[model samples]
Target: MNLNLRHAIMQNISGNSQEELRETIVDAIQNGEEKMLPGLGVLFEVIWQNCSEQDRQEMVQVLESSVRK
Candidate 1:
C-alpha cells in the first residue's frame, strides 16, 4: 500500500461521482481486502484536516459508530 499513490488517487478523483467510488470500494471489501479499510484512516485524516468544525464532529461520530460495531 503506497501512501503517495493513495493520496494521488484521492486528489485526482476527489470530485468524481461518489457512487462509482463507493461501488469500487465495496467490491474491494467483498474481495477480503485489508488495505481498503486501513487506507480509510488516511483519507479521514485528509478530510479532517480540511473539514469544518461541524463536519469534523460528524466524521468523528461516524467513525465512532463504526468502531463500536
Candidate 2:
C-alpha cells in the first residue's frame, strides 16, 4: 500500500478552525501514540514554513528547554 501521509493529513484537516486545530494537537499529545508523531511532524513542517525567524528561534529555545528539563 502506498500512502502520502503528509498530503493525506493536510487534506483531512485542510479547513479546520483554530479551536479545532488546537483540539487535534492536544488530543494527539495526550494520546501519546507513536502513530501520531508523523502527523505532528507534518503540522510542525507547516508551522516552520510559515513562521518568522524570531518565531523559529523561540520555538527552538522552547524545544531545547523542554528537552533539558
Model 1 C-alpha lDDT per residue in residues 11-48, reported as the tens digit of each score: 85578687876765667678777766755555556678
Error of 1 at 50 (Å): 3.3
lDDT (10s digit) by residue, model 2, range 1-69: 125988899998999999999999999999999999989999999999999999999999999999999
TM-score of each: 0.51, 0.93
With a 3 Å backbone cut-off (N, CA, C), the pairs that clash in candidate 1 are none
lDDT, candidates in the order shown: 0.72, 0.93
Off by over 4 Å in 2: 1-3
RMSD of model 1, in Å?
A: 3.3
The model with the greatest TM-score is 2
